[model samples]
Target: MIKNGEEKPTTNPVTAPYRYEISAEQCRSCDRCKKACKAGAIRGERGQAAYLIDEEK
Candidate 1:
């Protein structure tokens, strides 16, 4: 039975995946992750790079 305000435990393998947010200071404009990403969800501008969620995915 479940109780109110209780959370269910889950570890399903099919669940959505998450990405680690790299620090901006650490970014040397390497663009390695951008090239690595097949989804093309990364873009660089203004001397800084960021990961964007591509609608295609």
Candidate 2:
């Protein structure tokens, strides 16, 4: 209820799971962990990879 003018939602949007970064320097570029990430939060560039909870996730 709003005296001025407002709307309210009953539920919040579902957020994807969080991803923590693994040491890129230690990453072997095998992509094994990347394949294992069900959330598709793992991304790589130039042989160095990182895990992030981006919009794609």
Candidate 3:
């Protein structure tokens, strides 16, 4: 695509990255994953709440 006097390069773009998700009652809440996640996408409620990835983050 071109705009003004510049052209955007679309040779290589993100197609479909991994849609990571954890099923309900799947996470053991071991806190191991929380430590591993650098993006801090993993989130959950208190106690044994099921953890879900915050993709917006």
What's every prediction's RMSD, in angstroms?
9.0, 8.3, 5.7
TM-score of each: 0.48, 0.44, 0.57
Error of 3 at 27 (Å): 1.5
**Order of models, best lDDT first:** 3, 1, 2
Off by over 4 Å in 3: 1-14
* Alpha carbon lDDT at 22, candidate 1: 55
lDDT of residue 37 for candidate 3? 88
Q: State which candidate has the highest TM-score.
A: 3
Of candidate 1, the 10-residue stretch with the lowest lDDT total is 46-55
Q: Per-residue CA lDDT of candidate 3, range 1-57, in tens?
A: 323435644444556777887766577776667667899998765467777788887
In model 2, the runs with Cα more than 4 Å from the true position are 1-19, 45-56
lDDT by candidate, in order shown: 0.63, 0.60, 0.71
The sequence of per-residue lDDT tens digits that candidate 2 reaches over residues 1-57 is 223335554444556755476774677776776778787877665355544334556
Per-residue lDDT over 1-49 for candidate 1, one digit per residue giving the tens place of the 0 to 100 score: 3434558654555667776565676777677877887877767753556
- Alpha-carbon runs more than 4 Å astray in model 1: 1-12, 45-57
Best candidate according to lDDT:
3
